[model samples]
Target: MATGWAGDGAVQDQIDATVKDGIQRARSRLPSGPGLSHCEECEAAIPEARRRAIPGVRVCVACQEARDRDAAFCGYNRRGSKDSQLR
Candidate 1:
């Protein structure tokens, strides 16, 4: 049961929308076609095993790690407790 100004199923609708958006964002980031020998961002060697493991791998682990650190949170867990939100 929705309280306050929220209509019936409004919270669920918002949650569904958030999940859809996250899925789209993740799908968009995925690499396509053949994998590259070197990282696209830094031009570092991607290592033979990595290219084989991830079919369309684009960036090396170091560059990917940096990118990950830059965008650490995707805001997908906003419904958590205050402490979780802070983290």
Candidate 2:
């Protein structure tokens, strides 16, 4: 049961939507096609183990770490209270 200004099931709906969006975002980050022997960005050789493990691996550990560090968190709140939205 949703509380406050949100109607019945509104909180659940938001939670479900958030989960779906998170899943889609995660899927988008997965590299498609065959694994590359070298990193696409730095051209460093991707380890044999990484290629075998990930299947579609493209970047080396160093480059992947860098990319991860630079990546923005996609978990931004989808629903804000009316008061918050007004500001």
Using Cα atoms with residue i matched to residue i, what is each candidate's TM-score against the true structure?
0.57, 0.64
> Which candidate achieves the best lDDT against the true structure?
2
Which model scores highest in TM-score?
A: 2
By summed lDDT, the worst window of 10 consecutive residues in model 1 runs over 78-87
Alpha-carbon deviation at 16 in model 1, angstroms: 1.5
Q: For residues 1-87, what per-residue lDDT tens digits would candidate 1 score against the true structure? A: 566677888768867877888898888887778999999899999999988877799999999889888986646455666354233
Candidate 2: where is the Cα deviation over 4 Å?
1-8, 73-87
Model 1 score (lDDT):
0.80
